[model samples]
Target: MTQKNNHTIARSWDEFSEQLLGFIISRIHHKEDAEDILQEVYLKSINNIDKLQEDSNLNAWLYTVTRNAINDYFRNKQKNKETITQDIFTEDTDALNIKDSFCCLEPHINELPGKYKEVILLSEIEGLKHQEIADKLKLSLSAIKSRVVRGREMLKEKFVTCCKYRIDENGKLAGEPDCQRPECNH
Candidate 1:
């Protein structure tokens, strides 16, 4: 690696190692396994650092790498097991349930104001990356990111107001959709 890349890696390690470790541990639970995943994230980031654009968000990029490393750890662990047990699959099950539950929010999403609806549909429903949405909509990257964030916030408000949904202690969606509006049927 070049001198600049070396410095970048060192700086990233100093800046993000602890935070990334906590992130991994939150997902992985076991200390040793979380440490292993954190090490893998560091190595992967080192190997792919060149691919990261100079203007890209480093913190976001590192978190994304760390998240992927955690996912891989779980996936490989599942692959090596002879049979999957309920305990081993709880997290994935919860994630799947969350995804399935969110499907019911489509009508609420459609009700969002025009601008928020457009970006939310593209990013959340259509699964477009923020940059891709920006490119497609002829908007600046920052604008697209801002719109996505704002749109999610609005959607959360709609969930609370219309569907009476609230995040539970574990941060999962807790409440059932009980639409308060006369026209709604969630």
Candidate 2:
């Protein structure tokens, strides 16, 4: 509506954004996509600020908006797409070398059995607790823990192979382009 009213809403939104983002991201499978959707939520909220009633609960309104946005995203994709491929390697061209490294790692991750891949991503990337991952996946805690350990080991072995490093003889890392991370002291 008015400039002052818009400013108040934007300020209120800023106060709530971080907590809302964390909650929304927890439900979403992809962090990058979650961010994109969150941006859409902001734009929608700003544009519809006039429609919000004086008595409405802002927090509930925001949650409703976020949920609807997520639903719409899934619905639009479902309408267009057939079988979904594992999209482990998305375009991240800002750091070309880092993206290339991820591109190299993605195939190994994708090649793993589905359960293992899910366990690894939930544990490492999302930083979910074992119990949380277990609940989300509807598995026992011990089962989740075991899968995470096994998945990590499998990934390590695959990475070592991709690097072409001699595990026993040569203490040095391999000469493969993927193995040369600037941060790796080894």
Top-lDDT structure, candidate number: 1
**lDDT digits (tens) for residues 99-135 of candidate 1:** 3334446666788889889997777654578899999
Quote each prediction's TM-score.
0.44, 0.44
**lDDT values, one for every candidate:** 0.70, 0.65
Candidate 2 lDDT over 1-186, as tens digits, reads: 789668967887889888777867888777887887888888888888778888888778888888999888776554322111112211321233333445445466677899999987667544568999999999999999999778766765665666443332322222333464444323
* Count of residue pairs whose backbone atoms collide, per candidate: 0, 0
Off by over 4 Å in 1: 83-186
RMSD of model 2 against the true structure: 13.2
Q: Which sections of candidate 2 miss by over 4 Å? A: 83-186
RMSD of each: 16.3, 13.2
> Which residue pairs in candidate 1 have backbone atoms (N, alpha carbon, C) closer than 3 angstroms, thus clashing?
none
Position 177, candidate 1: lDDT: 56
